[model samples]
Target: GVDQLETYFGAYLPQFFYAMLAPLTLFVYVCTINVTSAVILLICVPLIPVSIAAVQTWAKKLLSKYWDQYTALGDTFLENLQGLTTLKIYQADEYKNSQMNEESEKFRKITMKVLTMQLNSISIMDFVAYGGAALGLIVSVLQFRSGHIDMAGCLLIILLSADFFIPMRQLGSFFHIAMNGMAASDKIFHFLDMKESEKGNQEFPDNHNISFRNVQFAYEAQRPILKNINVECPMGSFTAIVGESGCGKSTFAGILTKKNENFGGSITIGGVRLSDISEKSLMENVTYISHQSYMFKGTIRDNLRMSDPDAADDKMWEVLRSVKLDGYIKEQGGLDMKLNEQASNLSGGQRQRLALARALMRDNSVYIFDEATSNIDVESEDDIMAEVHNLARTKTVILISHRLANVVKADNIYVFSDGYVAECGKHEALLEKNGIYASLWNTQCEMENI
Candidate 1:
């Protein structure tokens, strides 16, 4: 260790030593003239830590602000990417870009402020370290003339005093870097301190019969998305939820799946209120496929394996065939064909099919399709809807769709509007009522040229 240290010093110290020839010459002049260097040593010692401490204090403040800005930037980026389609449809790309630039500029300004503070602190520290030492040496030399110290002692003190400041001053500057690290730690600790979702009662009956009794829920405080949503999805029966936009269709599905647990009233699965049931057990019986189908970045087979890791390749092929994606996959190099992030490399219909295949692999007792056919092409939509219709025969399916025609064959349909169930019946029965469901259905059918 000693040899290594000396070797490192030998490599870099000479360059620093050469750069300080003027100061070294001054020291040589003072010492040779029988001057003392005690005052120089004293000034260098205290100023090292004090100046560093000041810089460190400022660094802590700056880095804390930086972490906040970084987190905000990440959140904005995610939101922008998720809403990219809407932005493009509305031609608001420039608007979002400007917003992003605004946050970026704020980040840049904070970064510059930190850099400026560091530079100013370092400049002041360097002056205190070098200038004060120089002045102290001048005073010590004058004192030596008054017989305070001998020539040899003066030479040693002059040489050693400058050398002493080198390490202490550098170490002092490191205090600022340490403070920045501490500031980052503050954010990490805050995240760590946040309360995790609660673990509830674990007992669940083998049979999965979902029932919602006066279930009330809201994402925001006291503003209910779902208001007294009383419904029952009996075992071995399909239940379709028909609703217009913002009618709490998705919210109801979310509650049934136990994705969002903060709700009023009771939701029971197999006689066990979901709030009392453990998250793991609830997930085991329920599988939800939403409107925006997400695909993991891997081969098609790899993504299929996510739902059932022990599933054989042939089983996956069978499931793919069931969703009518097998022919396409086979033509496009089979399951070995890689899916990019969110399946961006594939068409919208293809991604939807892949998501369906994954869900089918789970083969859970309950299936929730929240506008699952929204993105597919007409031909693909027909094929996928057919597959969904078939799945509903055996599994307790909750189909939430705006396309009324798809739910025509459903055993029961509950129409929702303004966060309430405005109408409830089979598709034909609801159509006969000529209410909101009838209007929406007529409008959608006209648009589809059906």
Candidate 2:
């Protein structure tokens, strides 16, 4: 969008001035030779803009649709390209290829329509400009024949009649370029006009206890994800939220990180409203680590430093050692080893350990481990959980996971079912009740034994 606007302004401004000033100058010259010829030229110049305006009315809708399709096609292509390996694994490459081809065809049709509109508009402007010039020359010849103007004056009018319409005709050509920029600007303006989420200026309180009271959330109005969720993670407590898939375990934790703010009820941190806390203070106080934590394309030291930019080499190694990743880093060329995109070169366990190491480097008051141990080997998972337990001794740790075993040591376990908290207690207490939590735990135990 920026590129289109730049191209339009950079090239259109000079042409716009020429179109406005040059045609008036020529009109004055023509009037000196013959008033009637000057009047005819003046009248015809406006017809070019009339045709351009007519084209613009339709081109606006066409170009807007063209940009929409262009953006959609680009998004689809990038998504498919990034997931190409997964597609090939599932033998779905041909399907995705055909889907992309359909998107490309739609883009091609819109582009051709834009071109056709440009061509038709230009043709109309050409007819108005040249036909008007021809009309002026005809009048000049008539005045010459009637002896109202001399032969020199008539010949000059004939030569310069076309010049009168040339500037306006060129402007008609630039109108199409400007139209594209205008369409892009409309989208940008619409985005800028959207209402921002309200935030308060209060700083995070020193006491880090977190609580949710009757909190409810939904991505859509009808389908609620978290309903009447009331949980608490007091300072220096190991609070775990365990649930089956789609049971809102992650959604419960997501509220603390401000992933989604549109919810019912209220959440408070140290008796201060969650919404009252400023974004900077909230971010500085919380660290969220998920199973698929993003790793940038940089050295191991570089990725770790994102959590603590000024962290020294000794501190980095200490954090890495805590996650049992120090030996792996030392063998793989130390902290300076370059990681590929998403750190694809590292195994799943190694990546999670590295992510854990990075999180440990930050001195946050609250830590959220959202399925952080999933898909990793037993050894790496144990090492990561050990660090998490250690962190819980000081920081307020909220663990969200579907795995029943990992939450066995939690100070309090909140088991979510559907969108509500169905059970809440310690691991043994919930199991003794023989409720949803016990059912899930027993099923998992049976699966592992099998």
Candidate 3:
């Protein structure tokens, strides 16, 4: 899009403007030299633009289809590349490769069509531009032979006649660039017209308590992920949201973190609706940490300081120790330890722990961990969850996890199934009632024993 915009402004637009004005200016001088030759040039001038416009109408639609196919193929290729390892593990690499080849073929066909349109347009444009100039030149020579115009006038008419086609001819070559720029402009305008999330000026309370009442949400029409869900986590309480994958456990966490905001019903913190709270105020009061933590290639201290730039060395150590990574950090040369790109040097557990430490640096009133412990070792998971439980002593904590054992002591547990809350209570209470949570607990317990 940026490249198209650059070409549009830098080349096509300038030449198009010159084409619009230059011909009329040249037409006046040609008339003064020989009226008959000038009329010939004038008649041919409109044919060049008319032919270009006719070609443009066809090329425009072709370019749009070309871009769509090209982007879709790219997305499919990237997705397949990322999952190459898994595809091989499942012994489906050849099948997946075949799918990619099929998509590429579709893209190739669309590309051929686009090139055909461009070539066809160029052919028509070449005929009009050169043909128009040829007709004017022939007329000027005739007028010169008949003594209607002198030698100097004939030469001037011929010389200036070439300049007449220069701008329009150049525009012919840049027609594709103009088409791409127009398509890019359509997307840019649509993006600019999109409505941003509404924000409010009212300040949120320091004591953050979260509640979702009759909440319903869906990524698209006819496919709801969360339905009429109700849950509560008052200040100084630990709440657990447990469900099978794809049952909207993560979506619920996203709602609280404001990553997914367009939904039905109400989610509020302390008596204020989540939508009404300013993003700045919400960030200051709530922090959401997930399993896939992004770490830039920089010193450990650099990453931690991003959470709170004013954090002192002791404050960094405090958070690190809380996650039980202080001893490891000290052994590795403290806060100056350099993390490789994407923190590749650190183990998965270490990366997750480091992310947890960063989240701890923020003094938010509520913290939600979206499977932050899912990829870590058992020991690290225990230490991190223990520290998180301690942190919930003064702040609201929402834990969304598949591991039910860790949340057995939670103040309340909400079990989601098929997009709605099936049960809500303490672990012991749910087990006593033999509900969804009880069934999940039993299954996990059995797996652990094996």
Candidate 4:
């Protein structure tokens, strides 16, 4: 597409300029030689510019529709390519191919319409230019017969009349290129005008005390994910937000990370409203890590450097050791080890620990682990939970998990149920009530015993 654009512009730009100037320039000289024929030619001049404007106005809409269809069809094709393996696994490849064909057909129809409009516009310009030239020739012959102009003058009138309309003929061929360029420019300007995320200049302090008062949120109306959820997470504390899947515990973590900004109620960190703190300052003091953390295709050193580029080798090893991954990494060629795409070479536990090490490199005042230990062996979970406990001694730590055992020693725990806080207390206190939290725990306990 980029190469097409470049070629289109290169071919049409000079022709477009010459089309505008050549006819007008020749018309003046034609008038000097034969006024009658030049007047006939001039009569057609206003009509071409006006018709060009009208055709261009109409082509603007068609061009936009054509581009939209082209993009959609490309996206469908790309999706089919990326999901080909999944389609084959499920024996649904033919169905996906049929879907792609339908999109391609739709794009083809729009493309035909665009070409029709371009040719139709060019046809109108061709008719006017030729009609004017014919009229000029007829007028020049009449003047010649009456002896109002000499033979040389008459001959010049006929030749110059063809020249007069030649520029318009060239411009007719450039119609598609000019319109496409304008359309592309309009789209870029629209992107430039898009609004950025709203933030403030207020800086966050060293304090990491966090609180959410009557916080409310929902991905969609009537299907609320969080409802007036009030909670507190003090600095230097280990706070656990635990619940069954789909009970809004992850949504609660999302709110703290400011992903769902339109939620109701105020959330503050260090006494400053989340919206009030500058993005740079807030990120420096707070960060989020999840079990599904992405490890890009690069060396281990490259991935760790993304968190803190200037971090020394010793610091990287220290964090790796803290997560109990240093010994394995050291055995596997140390930090220079190459990671496959999505870190497929490592086990799930190794990937999560590497993600943890990357997160720790930032030294943020508050860390939110949104289900950071959802899967993996018990040893890895124990190692990560222990590290989280140690980090909570200074930096604020908030854990979101469904594994009841992991949060038993948390300083405080908030059990959520159907978008609301069902219980808030230490693990033992919540267990004593034998309510929703106790029920979930007891079910898991019995399953473990089995």
Candidate 5:
């Protein structure tokens, strides 16, 4: 898109004026010398655009297909590259390679079709331009022989005949590029014209209590993910949402953050409707951290500053100490120490701890930890949860975890099954009920014992 836009603005637009005016100026000059030849050249100049118009009907479809195949090839390559290790581990690399090769071949075939169409159009334009010039030259010779014009006039006509067609020929060339630019512009305009999500004018309410009443959500009409779900995560409480995978646990958190806004019921923050709160105000009061929280390739200080841009060095150290990462950072050359992409230079536990520390820098009223402690060492998980529990002392903390052990201390644990809340209460109460939560807890306990 950038390349096409640059070519359209930088080269095509300027050349467009020259192509239109240069031919007219030269045609008038030829007319002054030989009217017959000038008229013939003018007649032939239109054939160039006529041929372009003809090619355009076919070129538009071809270019669109070319772009589609190009995008598909790129996506396939990236997906394969990201999953290369897994493919090799499973001995499926050969199958993936074959799939990628098929996609590449399709792209190559479409690319050749685009080039062949361009060549054929250029050939037609060349034939019209030179044929018209040749015809004009013959007319000039015939006029000279009849003594209707002088030899000098005939030579001038011959010399300038090609000039008449040159501008139009250059235009024919630019027409193909213009077609490509227009194709890209079509996609860009479609995206730009799409309706944006509605914005609310209401400010964030002072009360941070959250309540979901009869919420229902589905990606498709036939497949519901959350059905008439009602839950509460009041301020100054620790609320945990736990369920088996595919039971809409994450979708519950997603609704509060406005990730999925097309729900049937009302979600309110304090007393204000969630949709009524402006996005800026909602974000200012809520912090969501997940297991795969992204870590940029920068210094430790640089990453922390994302949460609180003006946080001082002392404050950074304080948060790091809260996550028990301060000693590790100091040992690794302090906050200025550089991290590799995705913080791959650090161990998995270190990365999570650092992420938690960065999140701690923010003074948001609500903190949502969506499986934030997953895939980490027990020590790191315990340390992170300790800080999370501490935060629950005065803030609304919602924890979503797959591990049944993690939410045992939560003041309120909502157990989801299928879509609705199957069970919700303190850990001991949930276990005593012998329902979904109890079943999940017993299963995990049995696995741990094994």
Candidate 6:
């Protein structure tokens, strides 16, 4: 759309220039030059249009590089704003400013180069248009002296010549504007060309059993995050996954949510391959809540309603009560109280509980908590964990946590290490084995005593 406006102006320049110049120039010289002299002067008018059209075509091709730089400038500004808080905390404001200034200066320099090219083209076009007319007038006068034409006829020829080239000169300027607009259009077309992922053909099952068969995955291809991970989550039982930091704990949860898809082997939900299930259908059955719960700016009711848009006010309060958050909601002035950006108005624990309530409202068949209890206070954590355990009775629950205590009550526990499942069994069974799981358990136990 922006490009079209630029093209319109570029295409119209020639017409505008000639209309203004022809009448004025002809009016000035009509009473002065003889017929033969005027004919010679009129020859200069064609030069204006021809010169502008040719110059503009050449200049338009050169302006595209500048347009790309402008897009880059916008992209950088977006990145800087997103990371402004990090920059302030690290005292790196100066460093970021320097980078921003450098990009801006480069962008300014490129724009100036485009402008310089345009100015030079215009100067040359003007010279050809008016200079040729003047030279033509000199020759016509010499011809008039030789009795070749009458005075009024000379004036008419000159006036007509000026009329011809004025439009062409203005057109040359318009070409530059049109080309800049086209350069912007090219970027928009490129963005629009991105392909969406194709949906699979297999039908999804109503039941909610999830299993991974020799699954392997990595954010980076060479650095596998989960290697040969295999777990079977029964339709209505709690499965807990515990691991050290960077040991593919969250990656496992992400896989269950289909947020991380680069993997080897297969993951099936209710005997249907995860890849085969459409994203929307898969999302309908599963919900993953992480520690950092994103709360958009709105009332508490607004956030809850996002889970099930048509949920009634009573249903919202009921879900909040289930998550043990209804009392706090009432204390905070009920659901009408607004939350600021990212829910800054709520404390860390309140935000997590709200997230839990939001998840409960959805009533997804499968619920995965990835470090959901790691940040909140112990009291809040326990209340939420109790709620989770209760939910486990009717829905499949997958808990991935760094804290060993959080998953102790899980029906089955899997200990992960170096992208592989190092141990899997009941918590006591793993303790008896005295392997990786036992070692990790002991380490945490010793830390707690200290």
Give lDDT per model, in order: 0.77, 0.90, 0.87, 0.85, 0.90, 0.80
Tell me the tens digit of each residue's lDDT in model 2 across 106-194: 99999999999888888888998889889988999999999989999999998888888888887887788888998999999999999
Of candidate 1, the 10-residue stretch with the lowest lDDT total is 1-10
Per-model TM-score, in order, reads: 0.79, 0.96, 0.95, 0.89, 0.96, 0.78
What tens digits encode model 6's per-residue C-alpha lDDT throughout 175-242? 56666776677677788896755666665577868889999998887788998989989889899998
User: Candidates ranked by lDDT, best first?
Assistant: 5, 2, 3, 4, 6, 1
Q: What are the per-model C-alpha RMSD values against the true structure?
A: 7.1, 1.6, 1.7, 2.8, 1.6, 5.5
For all candidates, what are the clash counts? 0, 0, 0, 0, 0, 19
Q: Which residues of candidate 3, in runs, are more than 4 Å off?
A: none
Residue pairs in collision within model 1: none
The reply for model 6, stretches above 4 Å from the true place, is 1-86, 121-180, 201-203
TM-score of 4: 0.89
The true-structure Cα RMSD of candidate 5 reads: 1.6
Determine which window of 10 residues in candidate 6 has minimal summed lDDT: 30-39
Better of 3 and 5 by lDDT: 5
- Candidate 4's C-alpha lDDT? 0.85
lDDT of 4 by residue, 73-163 (tens): 8898898899989999999999988898899899889889988887788888888888888888889999999998889998888888778
lDDT of 1 by residue, 1-450 (tens): 122334334533453444345344555654554434643544355665677667767677787897689778889999999999999999999999999999999989988888888788878878877876576656656666777776665555556556645655565455445555567667667899989767776866677788888888889985778888778778877788987788899888877776777788888888876877887877887889986977989899899999998999899999999988898899879889888888899898888888999999998888899999996798878888999989988988989998888999988888877777778888789889999889988898898785
